[model samples]
Target: MQASQLSRVLVVGASAAGLTTVESLRRKGHTGPITVLGEEPHAPYDRPPLSKQVLSGAWEPERAALRTREALSGLDAEFVFGDPAVALDTAARTVRTRSGRDLAADVVVIATGVRARQLPGQDDQEGVHTLRTLDDALALRAGLLAAERLVVVGEGVLGSEIAATARTLGLDVTLAGPLAAPMALQVGPLVSGLLADLHTERGVRLRLGTGVAGLDSRDGRVTGVRLATGEALPADVVAVSIGAVPATQWLEGSGLTLDNGVVCDSRCRAADGIYAVGDVARWYHEGLGRLIRLENRTNATEQAAAVADAVLGDDRPYTPVPYFWTDQYDARLQVHGFLPADAEVDVVEGDPTARRFVARYRSEGRVTGVLGWNMPKQTRLRRQEIADAVAAAPAH
Candidate 1:
């Protein structure tokens, strides 16, 4: 297949991955028709800042946009705003949108990202929120300003970041989760322990290894979390960041693999002329010899580019060294490769006690991952090492 062979391309989800696919296609000399359908009415924007600057009131919502009118104009693609795709017909090569419009296409790229998972028994409440979209950040920011006590459930990157930002804003925030330490799944126990210490030192209460028995509220407004241990922690605001569920429900009958996300081949092809990218795509990694899905901003862009190439008839396998970063309080953590909580750790540079260091994670004598805390320069330089380690990972 070539650019000429593709007459029209339909990209679902007008997000970073979807917009990047359109840009990549145009840059690769693709002159075919392209249509982008977004669920949100706002223009595509960067989501990383929603948990940090936006929540902290340091950056406006417009500043987080991925493209301005001028930038999007150069892509020469049809933009469909506020209309979400509702169904996919793999055999007929068509898509149905919520507006009752059936779109035909020569190729389709599904970039439907994930949505934040809410806790059970949680409903639309004044003080309860989940940070995923710009609207979420705006609402949470306002909620934070008015509330004196904040309870953040789930101590993952998003929860921890929100806690840090809330604490910086002078809110009494209690960070609670089932994990022994925050971000232990991403950087191992040693680094996670240091993060626990950092948050405790910054006046953010830590309530690890706890489950919410219920949410206390007044007149349908969440006020605090009631622990399963028969204790109540009072709060004025609540944020749940447990995890995300891929937005792949619309693909249910499309004959596509839906395990965690839209499972794709090495080339990111989900089916005969269809592809998937971003957080909703769970593609096979040749290096890892396993199926993996990443929810990071960096992986979204890289995978979109690879999906674009694959749609253009390039069958090169997409194999990237997994990377993610989080800035909590005064600590900045960057990681390359995969680091499970149980992996053995080896100090690479600096020291954890100093709150600034880099460490390599190993499994069965092979360097499987790397972690950097407040070591941005060193972290960027360690990518090659991660790639090398991935290439040398043992066969399944």
Candidate 2:
């Protein structure tokens, strides 16, 4: 594919992946008419900071932005703000906006991302919120400052981080989730036990294996959550962080493969002249031997580069090890590679009792993943080392 031939590119969603896609195309010397359609009025911002630093009041909302207005404007890319793509016409290769505007493109990149899943009957309540976008984080932070009791509905990274922040702000927080352990999804049962201990030590109430029945509202202001067992936990604010559902509802008739997210091949190609990347893309990982959708900036940045190369017909399969990091209170947890349920977990260094350490997960005598607490540099190096080792080994 010649650079001149790859013209008229239209990228939907101005999040990390979409911004990187446009910049990548230009960096590859493709001087096509690039247009970035963003649903948010602001330019691309760092999402991880929203739940961590911004909500903690250590960083402002403007500081969380990844791209400045000048930087985005200087890229020579058309910036369409305050308009979200409403529908997709795959047959015509056009996208319809919520304002009823139609945009044509030679190639379409779906980086619409995912929205934080909300509990039923929670959206309309005043004190009920889900943090995903900058607005959500700002509102949540404000509410947390005034609330005495904070109820978090999920035990994932976002939920844990928010609970940590709420606690730091002198608010009583309760983490309500179905998992028996806090970090069960990433670090297995043993590590989850360690994480739960940390939360309990911080005076956080852990309500494990509990399901929220609905939101208790007083004249549209959320006051508490009704548990499945008919018990009502008194709270000033309820945050629904159940998980995230891919924002692919607009692609229902788009004729692209979507299973939980936009299903793409290893090359990130959903169809001819169309590709999907980032958290919204579900692609097969050769190392893991399964289709997985990751919600990390590392995946978004790395996959964006791969998608760029694939669009240029390089045929480079994206096989980078999935990596992620989370900041909870004083501890920084970093994860590298994949953690399969069947893998054997081993403690590499440090003890969970001290609340800082590294752990390795292996499958069939091969190290498949690494979990590090307060070990950023080690996590970075180990991810590359694991990817190389996995590449050299025979197919399992």
Instruction: Identify the leading candidate in terms of lDDT.
Output: 1
Over 1-396, each residue of candidate 2 has an lDDT whose tens digit, in order, gives 545577788899999999999888878877778888999998899899888889889997889888887888778999898999999888677999999999998889989999888787776889988999999999999998888999988887788888888888899999988788786777788777877888898989988777778888899898887778787878998888878989999999889888999998878888777889898999877765668888899989989888888877787778888888887778888889878778898777777677667888888888888988886776666676578766877664
Error of 2 at 46 (Å): 0.7
TM-score of model number 1: 0.98
C-alpha lDDT values of all predictions: 0.89, 0.85
Worst-scoring 10-residue span by lDDT in model 2:
376-385
Off by over 4 Å in 2: 392-396
What's every prediction's RMSD, in angstroms? 1.1, 1.6
- Predict model 1's lDDT versus the native: 0.89
Residue pairs clashing, model 2: none
